[model samples]
Target: MSETIPAGKGISAAQSKIENRLIETVVESFNKTEDPRLKVLMQSLTRHLHNFLREVRLTEDEWRTAIDFLTTAGHITDGKRQEFVLLSDVLGLSMQTIAMNNQAYKGATEATVFGPFFLENAPEIAIGGDIAGGAAGQPCWVEGTVTDSSASPVPGARIEVWEADEEGFYDVQYGDGRIAGRAHLFADENGKYAFWGLTPTPYPIPDDGPVGQLLESVGRSPVRASHLHFMVSADGLRSLVTHIFVAGDPQIEIGDSVFGVKDSLIKSFETQPAGTPTPDGRDLDGKAWARTRFDIVLAPALT
Candidate 1:
């Protein structure tokens, strides 16, 4: 025998039927997609998106607000500023994508977000040279070695480094087309590299746009811990993009705004008094300096 439904239950069941038909129609529209992967992706995306809308009983106003926020984020993006990447970062989507793509490897350095600030074709600097370019900050000596998984030095690997100054400003922030605290260098025959850079200081992710507004609405701080960025690459090895975070930085303990910090990537920066001999023999004018050593291990490239 057929069961009778109450009046409210009947209405709900009819509404659910309409929702299911809409989802099914949207998903079926992608059935003719040329790429198998794209077809699957579109179908899955439609299903999940429809489910989320139903689960939330989303209002039209809320959906419109989200659309407007994303539109504003795109409108503000330019050559030196990337608001979309910043949004992904603050939302932790960037780190989640990185983690999914970069599986852990024994002895290889853990990868982190390839922040929006990386510039292509950065001017190459000689070993032990100063990358700070007289930018304002305490003198810091950065020395490191590049090796393979087996611990053998991988000489001649390319290392690209960039960081903010003591005042917590990147070169791009100045908008003067001046390059500071960023350079490319190569490891020596013994896989050793050293350069002079400024001590990294905590700074906010460019929070002047919609992403910033989102952070404010969520009661979240926009500060990133002090860190030096690196992109190391060698032939026949998978490139490593990562950062060396300052040990004991309050932001690191509290959590980096971009979710990029890994406990394994933190290293202490030792303080040296003024007049100490610099590792690169560059004259520091008797200024007190900080120094740290980082070693990198690369994994073999997938064939």
Candidate 2:
């Protein structure tokens, strides 16, 4: 599918006037919506959509092609794969929606796109346990503290962590049943948390469907910056779904296909030679490992 709408001379002024009248009628029809928020949403959506159609003088053939593309996207979607999320990510709508919803608080960790790979009910781990669970990669020791914007420890905060293995394939991507490179653990009494994980590597978004074809037509790469996913939450605190990107990953400068990177989210991973004492004393069997710290600060809930 073509990524850009073909440039047109735009609709004539007379056509635009008639289009505006239709937009008015559509907006008025939504005024009867019982929910005020729904009413505004429908009216605004109608206006913007009509405006877009008019602005481009959208051709019937192009519109039909778009419909066909979306139909194919819908047809390929399933429980394990979400084509719509991929569409939104490629269009930058996912990141834009996240930005619009996540308000900034003093020194709180910034949030980023929650990629569609997260699964509910991940296996639980103790405060200082391994989340790797048999995934393949260089061992990494991840440590962090969960705190509020005021710098007070938020004990018992639940942190969900997941990442792709060294080969850039999430466990879910394999046909065989396997649970690896993902787990959740709660903060200790002082808000400290630690776990063993694989060092995150750069990977391409699932670009095998309509979304991929569209990107190729438009000359965009589907690779995301190397990073690890995190979702943190505690009572009365705003939940955060974000990622900590590896510092000095060349992909960071190359760009993330989903536009999920932030300078604040980047951190260094200290390299440790083989046989270095593991933080939680789990032996790596003579393999080199890495360590990184992420001190997370969450904002208060919007009441």
Candidate 3:
């Protein structure tokens, strides 16, 4: 069937009707919600969605196709995975939100979008321990300090860390619970923490949706830079979700398919001995990798 709108179909009039109905539905739903945040979110989303439809002069067929794509995205999701987060990442919406909310940390430590693969069960390890579990990749020791904005150490802070293996795959991606290149470490009494993990590598976002099509259409690559994800929390300090990008990783400058790259987030990954005993207390020599120290300074909570 030809997917063209029929002549004299009153496109504008139809759009007006649909838009009015949408606004009414949104207002009704918002009124039924008690959460202030949800109300703001729903109202803003409704206004923007309506504006977008009107601006684009969307046709019924296109809207239906879009809905179908979204449905398929949901269908593709299962335990240990989320296609919606993938969708958000590909559209750059995730990074945009992180950037907007982290504006206060611009000069301090830039934030990036957390991908869908981070799992909470990262094995806990001591300082100088390895998160690589046992993956083949460049050996890198990541050390850093967790502190408040004033540069005072926040000892006993918990840092949740995870990254892809040397082969550019996370534990979830591998689907084997290997937990390679992932760990959770606690800051010592000095607020200092360090661990070893395989240096990250550029990897592609899933490319099987409208978002993927959008990236291809724009002549963009779906690769993200090598980086380690970190979520740090401590008493009396605001929590932070951030990443440490490998400096000089070509992907950092060009291939962040999610638009999440920032100069401030990049750090040098220095060469280290390969014979470094694996994080498991076993001697594994000749494992070449990079090392870097990253310090995170958090903002004090507003009373």
* Model 3 worst lDDT window (10 residues): 1-10
TM match of model 3 to true structure: 0.85
Q: Is candidate 2 or candidate 3 better by lDDT?
A: 2
Off by over 4 Å in 2: 1-11
lDDT score for candidate 1 against the true structure? 0.88
Clashes of each: 0, 0, 7
Give the candidate order by descending TM-score: 2, 1, 3
TM-score of 1: 0.94
In model 1, which range of ten residues has the least summed lDDT?
1-10
Clash list (residue pairs), candidate 2: none
Writing each residue's lDDT as its tens digit, candidate 2 over 32-135 gives 89999998888878877877886777799999999999999999888777889999988899889988889788888999998878888899999878888898
Give the total clashing residue pairs for model 3. Answer: 7
User: What is the TM-score of each predicted model, taking all chains together?
Assistant: 0.94, 0.94, 0.85
Per residue, candidate 3 scores C-alpha lDDT tens digits across 1-303 of: 112222233567675665667666765667767898997788777777766676677899999988998888788787777889988887778988986777674235556788888787778999888887877777677888887777788899999998887667777877776667778889999899988777778888767666677678789897888788998888876677888888888877577877777777788887756665544454545656566889888876542
Models sorted by lDDT, best on top? 2, 1, 3
